[model samples]
Target: MAKVGRGLPAPKSKRRVKYGPNVVRLVCEDLASGMTYNEVTQGRGRPSHSSLYEWRRRYPEFAEATDAARAFGAEVCGDRALEVAEQATEETVRKAKLEVDTLVHRAAVLAPERWGGRGAGLRRAEPIEVVFSVRRFEKVVGPDGRVCVREIKPEGEV
Candidate 1:
């Protein structure tokens, strides 16, 4: 009988991403069209976000194009969020609102200057309902290395 040997994992193979002309165009367009790095990677057969960043670092043109696209993408996300908020129906209100919030956050992250920064939240073309929640908590981390949680008192006391 052959005995198997316990050994370290094999070295990772070098994955060569094909940065063809279309690759550059598509990546640039995705960014320019308001798609985040995560979104770009979500597409079928797309490269990882890290790879996209690495490519940008290696290629000056890619970096320039991506930088230009960031603001455009932020604006697009902001616009789409507003549209979703407006078109949301009673049945899909919760889902649509969540989507709006996500887009707003992404837009803000992409271009805080244009979106009025973190504290300002998102810009809306028209008045739309926004829902937010607040919670209070008390952190109790003992020597046991486990977190002990307690409800925070209303009077600013834990």
Candidate 2:
């Protein structure tokens, strides 16, 4: 029989991100052009998403710049949505509306202060619907002889 070693595997070294002015500039440009954080972090030679977040944590200026760039990206997405709406025709109306809706949703999430929750731009197609339910509780004895409160289903419910 061959002898097998029982030692732990070697630890992999972490990728070191090179911080530079151009790195920040390029990241900001992509963000300002409406690219998401995951999108920006993709591809070879780019820093991982966590590294970008770490940089933001390490440098307050980078955080602020990224925040501003994200807001600009939201605005850019909003503009693109508007353009899509403007160019929609009878045949393309459904697809155009879907694209515009997606872009507007992204914009609203990215920059809530600008276009979220009844703001001046691009309100949702339908008003939000809220439902309320009253749950009934009943005391039940468990197999362990412990009493616990359980939810009681309403009548005619399966």
Candidate 3:
């Protein structure tokens, strides 16, 4: 019969298993290839399941790579939005400048004296006839045709 101490079997060995880079790579590959936790555990010869989970959790490089990928996607989206906003702003400024230029050109051609000189005298023109009204004339049948009375506003009112 085997001897027992403190109701336990005797200690057998103290040698620790050394896992190389290849082993670590194999573990990472198996994890990335859609393997279940149990599958990875079994494939890796059932090494401490908690240890595998801890490796992924504690590795800074792995977390950094994942974060970088997400940040790159966000950067692309942000750049596109920035480009669209810049283009819209440029178009708006261009249209506003063009309208200003057109108004300036029309004013220059129509009344150059107002803009060209510091204190130019404005030219006066005769009042233009706008419309003819028929309210004052009575309707004549065949001979008189229609005599229309033209009405004009007071000089200052116009």
**What range of 10 consecutive residues in model 3 has the weakest lDDT sum?**
66-75
Candidate RMSDs in Å, in order, are 17.2, 13.8, 30.5
Between candidates 1 and 3, the TM-score winner? 1
Candidate 1 residue spans exceeding 4 A from truth: 1-15, 42-46, 90-92, 118-158
**Candidate whose lDDT is highest:** 2
lDDT of 2 at 88: 99
Model 2, 1-158: lDDT tens per residue? 65565476764455666978888999999999999998898776677888899999999999999999999999999999999999999999999999999999999888887878675666558988999989889999999999999988888885
Better of 1 and 3 by lDDT: 1
lDDT of 3 by residue, 1-158 (tens): 76557688775443333445565655555544434446666632444556555555887664454334333333343344445445555548776555545544433433355533345676757899899754333434455676555445555654
Candidate 1 TM-score over all chains jointly:
0.54
TM-scores, all candidates, are 0.54, 0.63, 0.26
Q: Which lDDT tens digits does candidate 1 get at residues 1-158?
A: 65465476764454555776787888778887987687777645567777887888998988888877887899899889999999999999999989998998888788777774635555456977999968677989979889899777678554
Alpha-carbon lDDT of model 1: 0.80
Candidate 3's C-alpha runs over 4 A off are 1-19, 43-46, 62-158
Better of 1 and 2 by TM-score: 2
Clash pairs of candidate 1?
34-73
| Candidate 3 lDDT (Cα, 0 to 1) | 0.49
- For residue 94, model 2's alpha carbon misses the true position, in angstroms, by 1.3
- Pairs of residues at least 3 apart in sequence or in different chains that clash in candidate 2: none
Clashing pairs in 3: none
- In terms of TM-score, which candidate is stronger, 2 or 3? 2
